[model samples]
Every structure is written in C-alpha cells, then in structure tokens.
Target: MADHEEDDLRMALRMSLQHSPPEAKRSKPRENAGVPTVSASPEESPEVKRRELMAAAAEKRMLMSKSVAASKPEKSADVAVAENSVLIVKDENRVLGGTVSEKPEAVCKEEEMKDVNFGEELPAADANQLFSMIFGNGVSRDILAQWSNQGIRFSSDPETAMGLVQHEGGPCGVLATLQAFVLKYLLFFPDELGKFTPNMPSQNLGSRRLSESECVTSGDFASLTEDGKASALVRSMVEILFLCGSKKRAVIATFSVLCQGAEEQSEDGQKDEIFAKTLEGLPIESASDLQKVLRVNTCTSQMSAFQQLKEMLPVFQSRLGAMLFLISALLSRGLEFVQADRDDPSPPLVTAPFGHASQEIVNLLLCGKAVPNVFDGRMDLGGGMFLKGIPTSVEVGFLTLLEYHNLCKVGQHLKCPKWPIWVVGSESHYTVLFAFDTSVQDENELEQWESQIRKSFDGQDQSGGGGFISVEGLHQVLRETGINLPPEKLDHLCSTGFIVWSEFWQILLELDKSLGGMKDSTGLMGKKQFDLFHFNGIAKSVLNGSQAISGVESPLQRPRLSILRVSVPPRWTPEEFMADIVVPPGPGGNDPSGKDTVVEVTKPEPSQHAPLVDCIRTRWPRSICNWVGDPPSIV
Candidate 1:
C-alpha cells in the first residue's frame, strides 16, 4: 500500500497485461503515475532499503493477481483458473521472491482458497527432496501429505481430516501402540520391508512431486477395516522409508547389518542374506517337516514341535512382510514385550512366535487353540496364504516370486535405492522377502508369576464353586493388595459388578502370548484366525493328536472359562508392568540373565503381603475373625 509499492504494482500490472490476448488487453491504467514521489536516498540504511524492496514485491504480487484476472475475464466462472493462476510473475528478475517487510496476502488468500476443500485440486507446493525419492513415480508430495493427514490432523492446520487429540492414550488407543511398535522395532529394521514401497516416477517437478493417480490421494485407505488399514499404512510407510535410502542414509548406517558378501554391503544386506540361505535350503525342504514345525503340542512332557525342529534344523532367519496388523494386535494391550517377574528386574528377550505369545488373541481370532510349544517357537515366517477359507503355509520358492524389474542389477551391488527395482535374471522383479525372527519366545518367569497371582487372590473351593467375584470384592482385594488397575481397563473387564476369575487368568495367558503388550483381558473379541501364530483351528487338531493334554480344549470349541487348567496366570498388576519401561542388557548382552532388559515391577514382600484377613475385613467389618476354621498363622 506504500506509494512506491503502488507505483511498482501499477507498472508490473501493465507489463503482465501486455501478454494477454488482444481482446483481454484493453485495460486502462487506473492511477496516474506521472507524479514523481520522494524516493529513499542511496545513503539510507540497508534495512530500510530492503523493506522497500519487500513492499514492492508485495505490490507486484497483487498486480500479478489483477493482471491475471483481467486476462481471464471470459472464463469468469472460475476466477482462480487460467492466466492469473499460473504461478509466473512478469519480469521474474525484477520480482522480489521474499517480501519480509510485508506478509504476502495474495499467496495467503490463494492457499486459503486451495484449502477450502480436499476435493479441490491442490496447487503443487515445494518439493520435499526426501519424499520425492521415497515415493518414486507412484506417490507424490500431495499424496504423502494426504496420507499423513489421514493419520493425524492438527487444529491449527487446515482441516482436511479429523483434528488430532493428543492425550495420555493418544487420539486413538491403537495409534499409541502403533507408534511404540514403529519407534521400537520397525524403524530399526527396514532392510526387507522397504522393497514393497512405491518409488518416484520422475526426477523433477514444482515444489512437491505429485502422483498422477487420484487413488493416491483418495481417503479410501481410511475406509478399510481397522486391521486392514493398519497393515496398508505400515507397508506404505516402510516402502517410503526404503525409497528414502538416499535421504535417510544416516539412519540407515545405524540399522544396517553387516553382510558376509562384500559386494552386498548395505542395510538391506541382512535380509538378502537370509533370503539366500532360505532359498538355498528350500530345494531340500520336506513338506511334512514344515507342517510338523507349526504344531504346538507335539507330545506330552515334550517342548513344542517348533522347539524340537529348531533343535534339529538350523534355525534360519527369514525376512517376512511387515505384519503391522498382527503387531498392532499384540501391542493393543500395552507396550510390554516380555513376561518377566516385576519384583525381579531384568532385560527380557523375545523367544519364538515373536509377537503372537497371547492365547486370548488366538482365541479371539477364532484360532481356537495353539500347539503345545508353538508359542515357544518362532512364528510361521512364510505361512503361505489362506486357501479357500482355510490357512495354508506357502510352498512357493523365491525365484518364482521375483518381478525382475532391475535385471541388470542381478548379482551386482546396489549403491543407493532407486526405483526399488531388483534384477533377478533376464527380468526385473520385486523382492518377495518374508519377515522372520528367531528371538520370539515365551518368558521364563511367565508361569511362575501366574502361579503367584492365583495363589494370592483365588478363593479356593475345591468342590468346583464357580470362580465368581464381585467388582466390589475385586476392588477391596486390589486395595488390600496395594494394586491399582486403570479405571478404563477396569470398566472394560467388569460389567455389572461380577467377573469370572478364569477370564482374568486368560489375560495373563495373553501377556505371554502378546510378548508383553497385554497385562489383562483387553481388546479381546471374536476375530478371524491368524495362522502365522498357528491360532487357526489347526492347533486344535494338533492338540487332539497329543495324548490329550488334560483340560486343553479343541480350538473348535468355544472359549470355556468355567474350566480351570492346572496352569493359570494371575491378575498381573499394572504397577509391575510400568516398572519395566526400559531394561538394560545383561553383562555382554547375552542370555546370561536369560531375561529381557525391563524394569522390575516391585512386588510386596511377605512382610508387606495383604493378609487374607484384611481383604475380608472390608465387607465383613462386624463378622468374627474365625470362619468356621482358619490357618494357625492367619497373618
């Protein structure tokens, strides 16, 4: 609005109007610029001179807008389209790109208009060099921005999605668990998962490289089922991260595992090696042996078949797809990764079936029962695909799975990830590496701790009185025991004051099953079978094959909470779980402690143990201490 700025804007407007079609160029000057104005002396401070330039730039932006409007008068229905919308400024050299003294109202107004609707064509912004590489040709900055908006939106940011509500549990409880999983593991290992990501199609664009496909920006991904959405999002993020190898090289350097093949030295080398080993061993593989390894209860008094097979075969690690859905399911409970004694602090290690350590998860998934030691073994890294409503382990080899997109790079070293193409032979293909982890296993202290909880709270009636306890009874017991359950969790577990103790025990079982994510019966519902953890009804057949492990029911049967197995996990205290936020490794990071690095949940010593007498006192304040007969030392 300054005099000099107005004059500059008038000149620029006239210059820009000259480019318009003859019919649109009959605009007359509205202001008289014949009058001379006092200009700043050369001796003026640099700051003042810079301010004038910024003012002039601001005016030029307005003039550019007006000139563009004048040229596109015939197309009046869409004011923002045609000539003025073109991001070109006349006399580009004379334009000041940065107008620090004044805010660019024209750009702001344009941005506001662009943001009015998600359906509006997003004017391309600046290209984020990193995303350009990660997204490849298939994805664009607009797409990434849309995807990110789908995950979390801010109140201050333009409303394209739901606003983010950050709190103790996060906007959605699921997102918190997802974050924990990513920050803890997925981020650390992108070697194999990155290959599936879509790559950039072209090298150059405006600010943001955009995908031509509308599907890339559509919110259809959000419409999928919870599990499906989680899986797709994680897979996409991984692919993006994989493609970002060039931009995120510093992070890659840390996670990159050393490869034995000198030519194949990079972060992705570890997965490549695993794939090679599995490929090499596949020619001599036995189908029956593969089936036997997935069996949970191979026999009585014997560890699971997985354990036996691992003992027999060389436990080769394999790279599987990022099973983000399953991992989310496991973490839905909490962030614990191992079931260790809270009283005794130690770093815990994950054994077989990395994430699927919980039976409740199995039971919920309609994967009725597990093989005897299936949880004790690794997950079915490549459990094939489900065939016609039935889960089946995959028998396909790696060679057939390749896309051979980069055939020229076959048997060659990769310097940086570009297009994510892999050369197999005469063809270029995609790497079909599955995820595998030998570290998934049951915690050593899981059962012992379960036993302790049952001993403390279980009001015994050997004659099979249903394990019924009122919520008030539980509340009284919890107070006496000095334990606190989160109010929300308590509300979910208890409805109308009564709860079956067996159901509570199922929570403990899930803890071991979920590594350490769940402490109680949380997020349990009817769901389909997950064969990777061998939760499908297959375990029922396998368990029936065993000399009938007493009390272990068939997966086909509905969950029977009335029956109590000899093995039962107690109501694990959340206090103990909180103590294990971080665990330091053993002396040399070996299995010396045979436990994961977790902070110990402090258990009250015998001296501090709540006396059964005290728990009864709350409800029976006036009753006599003697209940027909009592132990000699009641305390």
Candidate 2:
C-alpha cells in the first residue's frame, strides 16, 4: 500500500469507529480522524517513505483490531454492517462513496445497497435484448423464413394438423396418408385391432360397432391380443417414429397403413375394400386449412358440421390424441438423445396440439431439455406464467431461438473436442453439423467454395462439373440446389472450439468498453420474449425529446425521411389493376367516356397483333427497402 492510501484507510477506519455506538468506539489518540498519516517528513528518502507507510499500516491495523475486539458484540455487528459506509480515500486520491468501497474486504457491505438500488431503478435484463445486443438483426425473421420456406409447420394451426393427417407422398404426405390408413385398418380389420379404441367415453358414443372380424381375441373387450397383425402394426408405428424422428405417432401410424398395405394385400379381398371405403372419401385438411377449422364462427354450414363433429367424434379424438402423444414422447426423447450423444445431428421432432395441454406439452419438452428458442420465436419471458417453463431448460433462456442455438456454435460445442458441434438450420436452410477438420485446411468452407468456383470459371469449363460458373453464381446455385454436406463432415468442420462468423467477439468488445467508469445497466433477472425491431421503434419515440450525447454515436441508424411522387399512366382507369393494356375507343362516335358510339373511320386500321403487346409501364416511385449495416462495398 502507498503511504497516502494507508493514511486514508486509517483515517476512514477511525472516523467510522468514532461514529459507531459509544461502546464500540476505540479509545485512541486522534481516533476521530478520517485518515491516518505517517509521522514522516516530506523530504524523506523513497525507501524511508515506504517504511513509514508500512509502519503506519501496521499500527492502524493493530489499533482497529483491538478496538473491534473490545467493542461489545452487538455494537461490533452494527459497525460491520455499515463498514462499507466509511468514505475511504482511493489510491487515485479520490474519496469513495458510502455506497462504494476501495478495499476488497468491504465488498459485502457495499453490495447490499447496490443491489437494492439497482433492482429498484432498472428493469431486469431480458434474454431478447441480450441476444440482440450480441447477434445483430433479423435472427427471428430468418428462422421463421426458413421454416415457412421449407413447409415445416410447427402445428401453429389446425390446418397444419389436418395436413399431417392427409399428406400422401413426402414425410408430411406419408404422415397424412398413414392417418387415413390407420382409420381404414381399424374399421376393416377390427378383429386384429384391440385396445386402440378399447372403450369410448359414454358421452362421445356414436352408436357404431365393428363386425366380428374386427374384434381381435375379444374377451374383456378392452385388451387386444398382442399376437395379432394389429399388434404388429402398432409396433411398426413406433419404429417408424424412431427412424423418421417424427413426434406425431398418429401420423406415423397412418403412414404405416399405407406402407404396409403395399406389401400386405389380403387374399380374401378384405384390405382393399376397407381402404377404399374409409380413406378415399375422407375429408382431410392441409396445414393452411387447419386454422379455418379452429374458428369460433362459421360462414359455411360444413364448418358448423365439423365443429359439431369435434364434440360428437370420440373415435377421432381418441385416435388423434394417442397419435399426438406418441409424437410428443418421441420429440421429447429425441431432444434428450440429441443432447446426450454429442455425435448425433438428426433433425429434431416437432409436436403441437391445440388448447391448454399444448402448454403442458411445451413444459414437458423443455423439462426434457429441448431448446425452445430452437426455432426463431422469442421466449415470452414477461408476465406469462405459461412461459416460465419454456426458458428454464435451455442453455440460453428467454432469448430468440437463433440466439440460443448460436450459443452452441461449432466452436462452443467443440470446446474440448469431446463434444461435437450442435445441429442448426431449418428445412429451407440445409441443416448441417460443424466441426474442425485437417483435410478442410481453411477455417471457412464458404471461402473454399468461392475459390473453387473462381478457379473453375477461369479454367473455362475444364473442371469435372463442367461449365464456367462464377463465384457468386456458385453460391446462388448451391443455395438453390439445396444440396447439403454429409453429417460427418459438418461435425468434423466444427470440432474446433472457435467461431469465425459469429458475433460473440462483438459482445466481448462492448463489455470491455463499458467496464471503465461507465457501467452497463442492461441485464435481466428472468426470461422474456421480445422483438427488437419493434422495441427499436418504441425507443425512437421515447427518445424524441432527449438531448444527443456529445461525441457519442447514436445506437440507432437514422432513416432517411422523404416524400415520393408517383405518375399514373394515361388512359388507365383508377380502378384498373393495370392501365397500360387498355383498348382504344373504335373509330369514333361519342367517346366511350360514357356516350353512344358512332363510327368515324378516321382512326388508322388496328394492327392484327396490337392487343398482344399493349405494354404499360407503371411507376412504383415510393418503394422503400429498409436495411441494416454499412453501405454495400463496391468490391
């Protein structure tokens, strides 16, 4: 410690003790001083000055210790509690405040006041803000775009649910087809099926029963004989879910009916009849149509009928719920498995059912440790009790799904090389696992692609793939082609625990810049969902009257405010969608401007092909494109 610093500490300690209760006051000469000075001359040698400082510190420490020990326990407790209140001098010669301390030993006392005051004044830091501060813009939009582009409905609506039940080709189609198939299988071969529709709730009964052939090993009527083909069908459905990584078991079961039917034709002509009767005429919906079915009001009578059916259809509800449960279980399990096996990069399973139970399902999925923000949606961290469960399970809670996944970037995942890169990407964007690899050489694979494309183009179609493709063109082509690298390569590429394109470094820089004197007030206590762009708009409105900081950069980029003038084409009615392709009034009479027409024949003869090329040009003079970041580089 410096001589001045020691003197300050001694003085502050004494002043603090003097202010304490009478019994707690230490009886010493000049004990009321707020600083302790060394009894040395101003002309002392450097070494002598140091020795004096050391001696003064020792004397002060001994005096303070003795005073504390002699003080009554209760008084000592009071002093201890207010120890941080001592306004000690800092080494820089500045005095510390009652709410701050210079000595590390006094931090506890200082923190209590700081925390209380901080909480009272500032809102807790939110995950969405933290993520925006770290990553930049468009994370949420990008995610939604990817899912929408890829047709991966998260059961956001009923139309999606119905679509799953009606699809007949791709994975989604297979699920839909399978649903139809399951209905047929049960209706036709009830003898082989058991426990599937074991017993219906009495209120939901439709007064229908299957024939004798539909009852499998019937006894108690609820239990099915495991030895039958229906049992096999059920078992196969489970396997399909595991392999396809689908959480929708009903969809999987429906798919099984179709897949199995391809090979299992009944020699007695029973399966065909059942399939034709049950599946062919069934009214299934698409994802887009699911929302229409969930409406409270109906303009169409059929909608009303379906609504009534929902109440009357016990068999439909039971089968659908069971299938959905199977899907939910698989999704939950799949999440756990993905997290546990560092090597796994399989696609995640998805399930969402309507009503309150969906919230419970979300909770269960989170508890199973699936990252909720795994999609682009922000965690609804504020005010909603239902949202609490969603944020707690993931590594980065209450942030956008993009932010959470970004935290598990290849570098982060491969921190020890033992953990593989986490899987990221949507169906529209090819999902790829990343890892470090020696064979790749360069850290950026994109750079390699650019280089190859450039070289191939320079070589004039000499490359194996043929065609002289430009670097930019190659990127467009690949993105368009939607071809993805193998999972193993992706894992290898991201094995190293370091990131190149990520914005983590930017956050670190911001933190460092704020550490000196300027404290960062942004931090959250719990999870919350947010849209930064929306918030940004709100912030602009709030700061309309605020003074600009001197020499400080504005965090928000100012938008250019302007007015545009649009010119309408001649001869175009205001009501017309296109004004250019209008037919001119025939040789005259009164103008078609609402008068009877009389032929004047002064007009030149109409060209035979004039109608085909009546091209009109419209001006979109006021179009605007909002963008973030620096102006594009010329290069």
**Top TM-score model:** 1
Candidate 1 scores a C-alpha RMSD against the true structure in Å of 28.9
Give TM-scores for every candidate, taking all chains together and pairing residue i with residue i.
0.18, 0.17
- Model 2, residue 55: displacement in angstroms? 99
Candidate 2 local accuracy as lDDT?
A: 0.26
Candidate 1 C-alpha lDDT tens digits along 1-635: 34544555555434332322112222323365242333445335554454444445556466665676578553322133332222211111232323111211222233323211112221122112111211223333332322222222111212111112221111122222222222212222223233332332223321222132321222112222322222333432232222222222111100011112212122234534543453333221222222222211111111121122222111111211111122222222212311111111122111112211122222111111111111211234456622111021111111111112222111111111111111111111111111122111122244344555555456532325667677766665455544455566568668756767776665434443333323432211111111010000100112231335676655332100010011112224343432334443556675575665543342222211113223222211211232222221110
Stretches of candidate 2 off by over 4 Å are 1-277, 280-370, 373-424, 427-635
Q: Rate the local accuracy (lDDT) of all candidates.
A: 0.26, 0.26
**Candidate 2, residues 93-187: lDDT per residue as tens digits?**
12222212233222122223231111111112322222222122333333222212221111212211111121111122122222322322333
